[model samples]
Target chain A: MRFRGRALKAYVVASLAVLALHYIVPYTVLHRAEGFTLYAFWSILAAAWVVATVVFVSWGWLER
Target chain B: MVRTIAEFLATLVIYIAVGTAIALVSRRFGVKTSSEYFVAGYRLGGFLSSMTYAATTYSAFMMIGLVGFAYATGVGALGFELAYLLATLALLTVLAPRVWLMARERGWVSPTEMLSDLYGTNALGHLVAVLYLVALIPYISAQMIGVGSIFEGLGAGFGTGIAVAAALSLTWVVVAGVWSVASTDAYQGLWMITAALTYVLWVTLFLVPSAGLDIGRVAEAITKAGVSGLGGFWTPTTFTAFTVPWLFFAVTNPQVVQRVFMPANERSLKRLIQYFAIYAIIYTLIVTLVGLTARALTEVGVLGYISNRDLVTPTLLLAAHPALASFIYVSIVAAAISTSNSIVLSVTSSFVRDLYERRAREVRPRRSITLANSVVASLVATSAVVAFLRPGFVVEMSVLSSVILLPLAPVTIAGWVSEGVRGVARYSSLVAVVVGVSTALYSAAAYGPKKAFITTWFGVPISVWVLALSTLIVVAGLLLSRVKPHVGR
Candidate 1:
């Protein structure tokens, strides 16, 4: 249950990256896409970020 | 219309029966102590924990509020909601493990207790409990409003709808505490997702084509709407002001924060996050698509014009097949009830555990359970009265609650990082809550409840000011403390 320094650093970086992409990606790359298309793409990216971070931070325990 | 009414009534009856049965069955799990009653003895499995978490987190706001928001505002609603999801994942990743470990090791029953234990101040716990009660009543009332509006849209008397919604919320939580709430939340969560998916599929495949609409053209129209400044509903200031409070929801809202202590083990907590992420993505996409399609239909004159964004879903349902419409209506009820019960339970737990028992100076589990049940009943009545008065929009009440809760973020984050330093002083926490809440209330009154981002201070939103000011007070208090730092608990 200890908060590992490595995991904490990774989590912070990943969170910032996700937040940045959440704003940047939609406003830039998908700004002109249809509402549904933009929503679908952004949701997929956000969901992937959640999964990736969970896996990365819990790697040791998840592996067990 | 008669057919719709019959379908609605029949579906409602069935939904109540099924939910009651689930609650009754969950009672078999037992609740001999206040902890078991309040938190299901912290033995919830991964699936139940995840389902309850999902159901409680996403409410009638999804179907009634968010759908309309998407239809009216364009893609900004999507970005705003996804921002919340992303922030939630980030917060839960860091906070949930620490919360879980602390709760398990300390046998903490309420979030207020955890804070009090962290800072070593009973007054701090009572202050937080009072803040929770004040902030959460509006939120619980919003759920009631959602239900009442949906029922009224279906031709029921508005008073009847409010009474029915309040009764449904009150029944299960009073019946078996978190046992009933969690189990029923799991059941209703499944129904909500299924109903949403069904409605989206039916709308896309059958309704749109029958109306002679082309999906490609609709997409083009929606995209054009975004490009023409219609999507500017989420201006930079507005977006940051609205989304920032919600992003910290997992840590700020006691209903969800308390769920951090419910998982039976570390593995269960991991699964809870994974399952909720998947459910949230699917639910958000389906709801958003439905909203966008409804907007396109209105543009083409196939659907009637919507004066109020909140009326969009009800109007859309009028065109749906009777059976489908009935199921979706029931799903909205399910969403409202699931969320309302969790809030009622969390608020009641805070009142009973943090205020009542803490003052009684002796632990009496049986009396505490009874007292909590009475508090739930009273709170439900108060919320029903507030909903009948119609204080504000569902989304507005939600955002206001989060704004009131914004100060808690810095305090909680400080608790985790300042392990070697003296914890926040009791007076400091109290002052921060008062200042944050008063500023938020003043802003709400001045700018109106529907406006989430009120730019009162040099173009910055009032919410950001509340956070910054509260953090300064708490940090200053800690640095100014002359007491020696206590070792880690």
Candidate 2:
């Protein structure tokens, strides 16, 4: 009956962090570095979602 | 753009021949019952499920619309698209299992039917079915429009393009329902990704460098272009307005929600989410990079600045080898047809399973399948005509489909998280959805779709307004139900 779990918590935190970075970094630290720097940074962040997806599935968070 | 009519025609003919062969072969698996016809009897393997999901959800928008958006707006388009990818990944992780479990347990075929079951009313299901028709027709038509434009760009005649795309979608879905659609989607998905990878490599290796720029120089040029760089059009308000609706797309879009019901088991569902995420991120990068490369070329004066963003990819095609351009063009056509096929199948299933079956005393599987195929045909014809007409409101409606469908998010979330959400609570939630949709329509009409989406009341975008209003109504209904026992179903 309980829904809370470590993996779920980690997944939520990771997703929120990525979203925060998307909104914040572009206008803040990376604002002036909007060239390849911004592109590389965002690409890596986007790739992180795939890594998160792998972990979420492998760790059974979906089952939880 | 160089007109490669002969090459394009040849590639398109071969693509259709191969796709039709796949669809016809898929019928060997057979579709005898309503469930089998609509959802492949919940027997789609992991690979097929994932591939179909990717193909259906991405659409021509990724290559054509999204590439143009990035070319015109800058790297902000990457953020917008990636946000959608991330949200979809998160939502799939949390909700896919629950939805799949319920579908299997209850023998539900349509998303609306699941909602109707939750509220214990056929009326809500019927209402949602109607809403799907209104919201999705323009979206389907938009796919036809995209195909027509690509055909016109290639010197193939617009009307011929629309008819070809419409005929393919109709034939695919009607052949063996989901089986045929998914089978061909798997083929088309491969073509789409392969074409994308090829195009990106060519641009990065040849196109960019031949323009006297490397990745570094292109990056520098993009950054130097002030308004079209880093955060150009992606202001906080603009980003929020465009992204918030897509964040809930996993649940709000019934076409994808129905996909959640197709995986045969838990492992298939897991694979579905996992594979789709990988495909999505890779495809997302390929698209945005192409757009960025186009923008970079424009910066160096190798390519002219294109006011009409959609023409960016077509213009790029002029520089590509005719063979490569032909492949990419057919791939874009494949994207359109695959998307339209899935939408037609999903929407038809919604109409037949949710609305039609409810009124009949006993369900005849054969009759239901017949009616579903007929509806699929009718919907495709209607969408094709609309695409040909190219009404002003069609684009508005297409743009607003996500916003109009946004109200379904709160209703769906409540159904999933709560038990016995019936009677007045459910009724009030339905009313909330209606109100949200009406608000979206009025704003789009009053201020235009583009402006209406970004326009705000008290600093909140229209998307947020719709979501907040619907959520509030559902909450009030739940509270009212608690206070009065008789109001509970």
Candidate 3:
């Protein structure tokens, strides 16, 4: 009853996606690019969080 | 002494200014009900929640112990910060929603009360209360040492006494009270970003190009200075430290319990999580870079690498620009005050708000508890003094606190995981605490210090590994508890 089946799965998926990006996005900025490394890294990191939220909210169903 | 004077006065100003802002807002915006006082009336938006969480989470240590760790250890120290990435996101997805739901449903305002109120058991709740108090005292001591250290380091101009500075800080805490603490947190949170960004920019413009420092050059300086000169910083090292312990703070912390009450709904909760994580990641990365820049500048022959790692950033600022250093100095104090006040308010809430009020049950007037709250504040102060007197005692105690909190992970899991959990989860968490503490003490005695044998899978501290195993045992016990059929329903 507590699981909320699809909802919990969606939550887990979003979290993993964000953490996964956290691990790699830094590497991409540090190794893959030349200009604006810090800014790139910062924007990407913040955006991953944004994307994660989108990933999470996409799972919501209309209650009314 | 002048340094201490400047630091103390600056800290006092920031605290008063920020504290008053919180109080005014709380009253003006209508924190009329107990929920508002206790949990900001559960009306917090994502932005406020994110800032408060960061302010409460960072504390004096981020400026001191954390920066110090980076100063000494290099980027390899970042494992701690990185862990927070994993932790905070998890808290949003998992922990906060449950805590809010339970608190609202049962009106269970405190962690200790939630146990008995929701579960209908007093012994389990009381046991948790004891554990919480034990875990928090050293945390408070960590902040005390932060205040005391600033006092000792500054040394001349302000005519400040350690007791005087400490008292002034505690008074600021009493002023905004809890609401004030939150308000100040929002302000301090902004201050932290500004300080971090300013340091990054200042060092980049002044130190980096002039000294011919680049990423490779930074790495080279770190390598040449070896562990001793470079202070052992490397990029990976800095990232780890920032992430790890923060995971605990963001996800599992009882301190952030009130945060859950603030968000308007599930949608807001998700947004707050993302906001805090992104901000923390960005801010931490900047701090890590700034720390590396400090190493490079020192190695490139501009400044000296001071003995205390945390002092490196502030010390560097002091050497570079006195006027700018003053702001950083005050911000550091603000950071400390914001964090310490959060802890103080948290401990006070659990003690005076939960333990005291629950026993009385009758709608005890808020004013009646003022004296008790004062006593609790004094108790935290006394423990801090004791730690200051023998810092070694606090260091040992913090190691012990790590051991103590390990059990809570399972205890909380049980509370969330099962409706018919019964006594098994409760006893498991308590047992784990005792076992983990005993083992941690033995390990500390055996290994001495700074030699925690980290495991590969989690790289969790040895004490935490002990906790993980204990939690597993609790899980098994949980299974057993549920497996057994109830005789009467």
- Model number with the top lDDT: 2
DockQ of each: 0.45, 0.45, 0.18
Candidate 2, residue B437: CA error in Å?
Answer: 0.4
For candidate 3 chain A, which ten residues in a row score worst on lDDT? A31-40
Q: Report the lDDT tens digits of candidate 3 across residue range B297-329.
A: 777787776776868865766555554665666
Clash-forming residue pairs, model 1: none
- iRMS value of model 1? 3.8
Docking class of 3: incorrect
**Candidate 3: regions farther than 4 A off:** A1-7, A10-64, B1-15, B21-25, B29-35, B156-165, B214-216, B223-246, B387-390, B441-461, B483-489
Looking at candidate 3, what is the lDDT of residue B465?
62
RMSD of each: 2.8, 3.0, 5.4
RMSD of 3: 5.4
Better of 1 and 2 by TM-score: 2
lDDT (0-100) at residue B261 of candidate 1? 92
Q: Which candidate, 1 or 3, has the higher DockQ?
A: 1
**Model 2 docking tier (incorrect/acceptable/medium/high):** acceptable
In the range B256-318, model 1's lDDT, one tens digit per residue, is 988989998888888888888889888987898788888888777788768798888888888
lDDT of 2 by residue, B246-299 (tens): 999999988899999999887888889989999999999999999988988888
